[model samples]
Target: MSQILKLFNFIRIFWFLILPLVCFGQEKEKPRLELGGAFRVNYVYSSWKEEQKTKGGEFGYDMFRINAKASYKNIFLNAEYRLYSEAFGGGFLKQGWVGYKFNKKDELHAGLVYVPFGIKQYNSHNWFFNITYYVGLEDDHDMGLKYLHTGDKWDYAFAFLKNAEELNFGGGVENSSSRYSYDVVGRNKETNQFNGKVVRKLGQHIKHRIGFSGQYGSLYNIDTNKNGHHYALGLHYEMNWKNWNLKTEAITVSHAPENAPGESNKIIKMGAYGTPYEVASDFNMYTAAVSKKISVNWGPISQIEVYNDFGYMQKKEKEFTDSFQNVTGLLVTAGQVYTYIDYAAGYNHSWLGGNFVDDFSAGNPDAKWEARFNINIGYYF
Candidate 1:
């Protein structure tokens, strides 16, 4: 851990030292450097099963991030450093990339960046994101090289990513279950991965965007000395008009097991909660959200946004019941600050951390609802 801290400090010092030079040393023709970040705090309450209810509210600093970007002619550098309270993680580099522009509409980048999957921007209004996020398939980032192109009516991105989502250099116990971290399990010793997405817009007042994404890679099972295939396909759509926005996505992911009968379900280990658990080989998820923005000037609030989000997950095996989650929230923005208050409920099972369905189920197959209340405040600079 000390070594990791030292490395982090070095990177921090290096960036801080170079930022001033990049901002002022360039000629006037060069684009000016941009700096921004946000600080957030949250309070949470959960009332699930009798034993899992929160007696007192959980409150603390959520996260803080610093963003820096600069452009010298067509060459650009962008980076962000994130610090989270103990509950999330100590600190980490969320994004750090350097890119070169080939033209006004095309650019190439290398380093740690977001994977090209699902919705690119504003997919969910909730802080936990959608179900895809819990399944290690949504809004995820990785180390890779990427190519991006933006057009008047269309946009596309393609990337080559490392088999392992994030690099772990300290040789410590890997947090296999945490949604914030990544680990390869089962016979699938991940190799290389290819991901790409394309989006096209249609209509005018009721503008719409549709996207398709796919990923493929190889996996190995060490116990049997066998290899298999890992792949996923996703479809997403978004529509906006006046003051309302709607988004939806569906994804199918599979991990083929070596030597397993084609008609039988393959058992595989997946990351969840802070550890890994075994589940069927194939999983499918569907999510949708609708939000309405209202411009208002009441007290210190200048705008109010209300949204409802829903997600459903289906496991290949019938023994394990499916899961569903829904969230309704209101976001109020005042100047550079915003506050979000939400009520979330889940049934059968959910990936949203606080759900206590497993504890209450007690071998019962029937679904029960688990609920939580969350409030978060953030300030941007």
Candidate 2:
């Protein structure tokens, strides 16, 4: 309770400080404010383990998100709050930030923002992105301060973050209840981090981005105190021609204990499955996707896109086998709404970048292939 109060107080103070600056402008121009949001729902069908199988279809709320933005001259504030049925009856602060633009080429921001690692955007066209996104290596948000620079041919960002996933004032055992839970994993604790990325545009049809990301923290073990570290190097490429788009990225992530015995090992929970397993210290991941947009003149159907996304993870260990996932889908968009239908098939477990699932039972290995069909519809207002 005390920690919650402290978090609330911090936000309140920040709000008060920014309110005066935004309200008392040098010019008479009124500040601009915009309110928008989105609602999403999904229907899913999956073949569970033979013993757990059932014939009934499943439907549920996907998400409800609200976005707010306010700007006055060069200072601006942006925030997003979301509610999810799978988030265990709690809301999430996806993004909340304040920024000031120094010029066209430079800007600074402070608050919770996406980490600068791997590909800057979604690595796949499907609703479930590449495996890297599941393990806090890609498309993950963190509380931090970031500086960005944009030039005629290049772009770069540098950031320093406290904690990996979200801001938690009440620090105790890390939580791992739902997919939307922001707590750091037990084996990979990201206390503080320095992340950087750079992109170079070579031509109108092709471009490249390379990034180096690293984090230093400690493992979340109540019995033993051990420091852990994470490092990754990634290369991303994109090509565009007419209505076709191609994107790919390859990243290598290494996680290890800073100081520990030679035989020290810990059982950690996998993010997607929430099952405990031992993992190797190193792994590699690759992802690729291609999409084509077809223009349409039909009523309420401006465009249709077809895409196939693939992801692979290779773990450098004898105890674990590699895993991969493939998603093929179509996206239809009209005005402020879009719908997606996709089929995903994977082996062993969800592609978790370097994170791998262990054998669940002697006869029933978790590495068995599984498939799921999903349809999602969303509207923006």
1-381: candidate 2 lDDT, tens digit per residue: 443354355456546765775677646877776778899999887765343247554778787777778888888888776666433433556677888999989988888877777666677777877656655666677778888888977888888877644334454555443334223455345566777888776666554444444444444443345556656777887777788877788887666554334444422343422333444456778888889999998999999999998887777654656667788998999899988988877765533222234521111234466777888999989
Q: How many collisions per candidate? A: 7, 1
- List pairs with backbone clashes in candidate 2: 348-367
Stretches of model 2 off by over 4 angstroms after superposition: 1-22, 49-56, 86-89, 175-183, 205-223, 258-280, 350-366
Q: Which ten-residue region of model 2 has the weakest summed lDDT? A: 354-363
- Compute the lDDT for candidate 2: 0.66
Rate residue 97 of model 1 by lDDT.
81
Q: What is the lDDT of candidate 1?
A: 0.71
Estimate, for each residue in 1-381, the C-alpha lDDT of model 1 and write its tens digit: 643474468467857866775766566654557878899999888775344353576778887777888777788888777776544445666667888999999999988777788897546887667656655676666677899999889999999976554444432333234334333543345556798899998889899999998988766554455667778898999999999999999988887756434433355555533455454467788899999999997888899999999988777655656767798999999999989999888765444443332311121255467777899999989
Looking at candidate 1, what is the lDDT of residue 308? Answer: 95
Q: Scored by CA lDDT, what does every candidate get?
A: 0.71, 0.66
TM-score of each: 0.84, 0.82
For model 1 the TM-score comes to 0.84
